[model samples]
Target chain A: MRISIPVSVGIFLLLLWEMGCRAWAVPVYILPPPSEVLCTALSQYRILAYHGSVTLFEILAGLALAIAVSIPMASAMFLFPWVERALAPFLVASQAIPVFALAPVLVVWFGYGIESKVIMATVIIFFPLTVNLLEGFKSCDRRHVELFRMMGYSKYGTLKKLFWPWALPYFFAGLKVAVSVATIGAVIGEWVGAQRGLGYLMIQSNARLKTDMVFAAILWLSAIGLVLWWLAGIMSRRYAPWKDRG
Target chain B: MTLVSVEGLKKDFDGLSVLSDFSLSVDRGSFVSLIGPSGCGKSTFFDLLTGAIAPDEGRILWEGRTISDLSKKAAWMAQSDLLLPWMSALDNALLPRLSPKKSDRERAMALFCELGLEGFEDYLPYRLSGGMRQRNALARTIMFDRELILLDEPLSALDSLTRQDLQGLLVSLQRDFGKTIVMITHDVEEALVTSDFVVVLSDQPMSVRSSYELIGTKPRLRDDSYVVGLRREILDMLGGHGP
Candidate 1:
């Protein structure tokens, strides 16, 4: 799990891959050499970083927006119950159509601005946080809730005391999974119709048959996801230590 | 006047009756225990008494008034010792303060001292073992001046030694508070030791099998041979043939 060992293993694997492609005498257009990809990424570092920033902004903005909107939405949904009744089926139906398919339509409607990318990210990230957190909120120990009720605690008080802790572990788990999907959603939107961002770069590189550029852009995107994962890990340990995975 | 009065209690689920013609009265500050088998209606009675649900037919009066109109006057502490995992012992103990007061951290901390929970107040429930959580829960329950405390086997989930330890602590706390308590437990000796009155209940279509006043003195719960014999007798009555 440590970075040094994994980096070494990855380097060894990349060396093997680069050697195999050379030995099979495959066209450079098909399977790019790892050495060539690394050089392109270094040469184009500023350009890639600017594009990567666009995708990063979209992912984080949507993630924050989703949490702000959905946590209250989940709490309200749980308390009223009818809200969940009315919305859950439609929410599930949205996920049934893959985001990649949805992305083209979103771009067509919203044009190439960051708005489409952010919308895609919000749609992708909202469900997991809402479902897992709502489940956690509702799954509180009935006894604890009754104890509060017996003490004459109001609805708001009970939510703060009895249900909030129960929901914290669940919220963290949903956030972790949603963070990854957030990247994919942002990329999907950017891929469909965007002038900038890593996804757009990869799309353009693929069209030109510049496999190394595509691969390099992919490597940076994966690195971005890894950072999100690492941050989520730290957050779970610090804030929601009760969760098992932490 | 009785702090809690239950009369002509009856309940049925899907055509199966649990309690029939159940009746009991507890003066304020009295200790009462209900001992029974698994499917017995003692727990159901607690549920009804606490307004967790309404019995199909019954009247429960608290402090000489119907609890239906005074729902907050009774506290039911459950067997699992449910503590909020994210909160510190102090905060969990302070949870009852949500009843109406400001988050009374000082009152909760004072209780920690009184309950021997001083050094452990800031620790989370997960950091403490089962015994410690139960201890914290008892401290929490102490904050309420509710006329009646219904404990649904509040310490049942603990191991034997820990359970015994809690029984002593609980007896002392009950004596000090003088809050009317109706504890439901499968442990007959626990019933004998902790109660001014003991009611034994039978299984499904359940009702009180027998009610007895356990006035025999000096810690009859675990450390007494006579109490153990009575426990066996009660077990036998429940059809438990065991070592």
Candidate 2:
């Protein structure tokens, strides 16, 4: 009942949109109706599949690299205050320059290849992942930390048992944001210079005024982002069930 | 039979003295309590004893050697029930064991039964009531098999009935298992009821102002006039009416 209500509302909205476009004699070029977009998706399935898969690969690869990099970096910052102080400013400064501006530079440095796209996504995802997880580590309950200290648990043990469990929800929160923006990161990289992927296809379709094809590409990108966010929710619930109730 | 001893201990936090020139000794298998007014550095005294913090100028000896030289032989249960929120009561009870064996689980389960938390083993810390959580905390403290247990107002948050119940459990844990127990409380009567000796302290820069030896049988029955008289005497001491 909970899931069906929102989904029904979404279908109702799509229907209204489709009818509104047709009733007003709106040009498909200006705004593709739902039916035209669906037809484009079906007819250009082969082309869409190839580009969608490339975008998906870049986003996932970039997100995985971000997770891999952020875990150790956050841990280093948490475990060593001096290291956090020295590096945190640089990390903050890195985010000050917009990622869109960095995308072209990344393409130039990495030769407009998949490497640049992946790196761009990684850079975009890394900031939130590191910041949220590090904040979680810092916010560990003092009593719990003292309990570990009294038990003679090593610092590493405390991190694994106490810190990790407490910080996991925050990690997922960061992950959700990172995953949603991952598509944006990959798309920006592809837009700078790329022969394949949804972003490149959108640019190509837009130039030709193939509005339906552009909308189809957007649908695919949003689908991937939605799937990633849903996956994060599932993972968070699985690992931290106690938090689910609260 | 002296299990742990603190001599000439002094401590300061940011140049504000807490405990100064404090000395104490705990006999093996005895239940001792420190009862004083609030902000008397009673908790700080336990922190020093547990090696959670170091004294500026004193030594704590566990079994005739410096406490630092000894491995963790004492468990400290604080005023707040420090059960990990993510863990079930059973897991929280067995946490101090680090790598819990099968027997550890059985022991934890047994403790749950003993602590009146039998059916709530799988309940998360948040699911348990405050009294149950504190019982679980107590179970965790005892599960590690430590010789000395440092309890900093472990029952302060409990209702009168539950506090009395846990006080009984503490007495049995001391008498039956011969665990050396040191507790701190603001309630003078609670100290008399639960401990063999009560170490009273003055308010900041705490030192042992006086001591009261509860001379009676186990459980320190209130029906005994001696207990009543001593309680009055301790209250007088706390109220600043003692010599």
Candidate 3:
């Protein structure tokens, strides 16, 4: 029923969109019908797949870099209060500056390559992962800490046996959020200056007035986001199964 | 034979005094319960004993030696089980030793079996019942292998039946294992039944109001006339603070 309800609602919405376009005799350039978008997606599968793979690579690489950096960064921030105090403002400022505004600079510095897009995705993904993990570590129960202290657990021992396990759910929470927004950074980086990726394809298709192709590119991007989100969910369940019990 | 002795210990938090000139002595292989009014400094006393926080005045002596770090001498269990949710029951019990070998696992498994959590060793804490979780916590405390065990309202969160069951188990810690125990509890009957000595405390700026020696075998009957008499006397002394 959970699956059917949303699936049926989606089908109804698509039918309404198709009928509305036909009834209004909308210009194809202004808004192509769903059927035309689907046809374009099927006919141009190879090109879309090629560009989708590039965007996928950028998103995955960016996510990997973000995870690799954020875990240690969060640990350091937790272990040493000085690091968090020094970097907190900069972390917030990184998020405050629009990624779109920084896209062009990243392209110039990294030279319109996958490196720029991956870096962009990492910048976007870093804040949430670090903050959530830090919060998770900080959330270790005072009673548990006392227990560990009374058990003669050292600083490193407490972090490994207590804080790391405690913060895992939070890590996955940040990862899920990071995965959903991961495409934004890579795609925007591609849009600013890139010869590949779905973002570039969207810009190219829009310039030619191929609205159907633009919509098709959007569909592929959504698919990639959903897959990443689903993978994050699976990993979260596997590693932090206790979360589900609660 | 004294395992722990506190001399005129005073603790204050931001000018609010909790324990003042509090003194108590616990003998080796004895179960002692501290009962008092709500919001009393019973927990703070346990904290001082465990050396989680320092007393502003006076000192705590473990085996007659003034020690600041009591981690090596005592194991503490709070009201809540405080078990790590991510770990299974066996792993939680094995927390005292971070890196456990085959014998450690076997010892933990033996403790689980003895605690009646035999088949549930692999279960996470959330999956266990309230009583089971506390038992798991007890296993962890026992695994600490310290001479002294300090418990802060350890069975207050369980249901009445579970509370009674655990009361028996607590008595065994002193009888079978021969470990000294200091527990804080609101339940007068629990103290009467399980402890060798029951010390009553006053309200904030806690000091020993009185102490009673329960001169009888443990797991004492609730309806015994001597037990009944002592229970009423303690309750009356509490002056409406009784649980």
| CAPRI rating of model 1 | medium
Candidate 2 lDDT score at position B149: 87
Error of 1 at A169 (Å): 1.7
TM-score of each: 0.91, 0.87, 0.96
Per-residue error (Å), model 3, residue A135: 0.8
Q: Candidate 1: deviation at residue B42, Å?
A: 2.4
Candidate 2 wrongly placed segments (more than 4 Å): A1-50, B68-71, B102-106, B117-123, B221-233, B239-243
lDDT of 2 by residue, B184-203 (tens): 88777778877899888887
Looking at model 1, residue B183 earns an lDDT score of 85
What is the TM-score (0 to 1) of candidate 2? 0.87
Give the docking tier of candidate 3.
Answer: medium
Q: TM-score chain B for all models.
A: 0.89, 0.93, 0.97
Cα error of candidate 2 at position A50, Å? 4.1
| lDDT digits (tens) for residues A103-192 of candidate 3 | 999999999889999999999998899999999999988888889988888999999988998899999999999999999999999999
Q: Better model by TM-score, 1 or 3?
A: 3
Q: Under CAPRI classification, how is model 2 graded?
A: medium
Worst 10 residues of 1 chain A by lDDT: A237-246
By DockQ: ranked, best first: 3, 1, 2
Better of 1 and 3 by lDDT: 3
